[model samples]
Target chain A: MMAVVTVAIAVQGNLFAVVVLGSIYSFLMATALVALDAVDVAMTEASVGAGISTVLLLGALHLVRGEEQKPRGRPWLPLAASVVMAGVLVYGTFGLPGFSDAGAPIHQHVVPRYLNDAVRETGVPNVVTAVLASYRGYDTLGETTVVFTAGAGVIALLRRRRRDRRDGDVR
Target chain B: MRNYLVLRVVAKIMIPFMLLYALYVQFHGDYGPGGGFQAGVIIAAAIIFYAIVFGLATARRVVPDWLVETCLAAGVLIYAGVGLVGILLGGNFLDYFVLDRDPVAGQHRGIFWVEAGVCVTVAGVMLKIFYMFAGRRREDDDA
Candidate 1:
């Protein structure tokens, strides 16, 4: 099913179609995550990726006309670079621990403590929340700051008034 | 067009419930998939729906610009204050253990307040962004 969606999207390269397909892909991935019991991450992905990001992108499309433009030249360098990266990833993943292996080092180490005592420690029933806001809080704080900085940049850029061409008066 | 009055009436009836549910998600985030971010977006969506149907002027009247700015700053300040408490208690940065007599309880206490802060900031930011975008539409229409 996922491959069908992927192939359909890959075949249809129009901008609007791409956006809709991407949104579908995002929601599907979120559903897969939920099925794997990563509900919190799934919720975040569905909301942020499928909902907000897609809405924002569509709004941007409204601002900019959607006309298909072809690249001037073949992007051979980027394609070759990505192929090398994919080859490295495939080689590396072959050496990875089997899926859902309890004996994996990840399951044995930091994850065990979070799984065992997250609720008792953080007073939050959502283990993801406990880990996000309590155990790994500094990282979340940094991410929030980055978002704030981006907002500030957008506000500064857009808040300026430009003179009207017809009226010879400032907006 | 006249028949759409029913839609308006339904929206008026439903919006309050939506806002309340957002708050419920914000506070109940400790137990469920929801948290600050989800709550923030939910609140923003409610407000956005209002603006879409009732007009931007109505939303401005409801949320007001200054309150949004204040909420954003207040959330960050609250989050930072928790870390400051850790510093005052002679623990490393954001060490919730020293906030209370019992380390476990302190951690819980600290996490709650910080999460609350995140909720406030997120809600504020979401509203602010909506206003900006909605405001742009007005400008475009004027042009």
Candidate 2:
């Protein structure tokens, strides 16, 4: 947490800072996932979040310069809003389960069986895969659809407007 | 032009080995930390390397836009098609027990096919994005 805060502070005034911070946060989250025994999720986060997202963002940065255009609006409203959000989130966390509480409802749920028997049933050593592909396969299917949708969106966005106009002109 | 020669030679040497490793990882995921996603990225990275080295026109010639689109569709179709097969065989959706007489073997079969589909889709998407970005960069460079 302290390291994340320091990194965030270091990147406070840069556009690429957000990307760096996000990548760091992702890697940290991947570590957290590993601690939680979700190795597959951790792997995905490490690869997709830390690796791919950073590279994609860098590519985008190459196209669009990373320097911030000077702020043209009053900062108070946004600052106050963010503060309120932070406060509410912090307050909400007070009532939430403490980390690593063995007696927590989450620990007592059906997930324990998933953690234990996933390998035996799915024949996959990665419990995350067993759960993702077997237990919640429908959700995974939906995720695939979302990815397809994003791909379609990119194609649509990147389609040559001039090409369309040219086709119309020919017609 | 000077850098191109080096990139082309390195890519030529590396791509085949990288793709071979991807296939290996995809097939060996049942026993290791590798899977469809890893294989997909590795393969896509190789293609991106090829495009960067040999030029987008050449890369696209090797793997045309239509092929990428088809791969994207085919992956999803394969996944859904398998589930539909299960349904047709009188089981719940994706219930692999109906895929074969033995339930365990059926699960393996289901996972293998689905992972393959995932690999295809992911690789296509990655290459698609790389092409988009690289094409954009080329346009910018030209201008």
lDDT of 2 at B29: 75
lDDT digits (tens) for residues B1-143 of candidate 2:
32777767877899999899889878877766667777777787777667767778999999999999887777777777778988999999977667778776777778777777777887788777777776777766775
User: Which lDDT tens digits does candidate 1 get at residues B1-143?
Assistant: 22478878988998899889888877787887877777777777787778767877888998898888788778777887888889999997788989899887898788888877877777777677667766776677687
Instruction: Please name the candidate that would achieve the greatest DockQ relative to the true structure.
Output: 1
Candidate 2 true-interface contact recovery: 0.18
Cα lDDT of model 1 by residue, A88-135, tens digit = 999999999999889998898899899999877766778888888889
The docking category that best describes candidate 2 is acceptable
lDDT leader? 1
Error of 1 at A30 (Å): 1.3
Query: Model 2 over residues A1-171: C-alpha lDDT tens digits?
Result: 837655674547676887888788888888988888766567678767876667677778888877767679868898899889999999999998888788889889888999888776767776655565667767766766666677777777776743675587789
| C-alpha lDDT of residue A29 in model 1 | 94
- iRMS of candidate 2, one decimal? 2.0
Quality of model 2 by C-alpha lDDT: 0.76
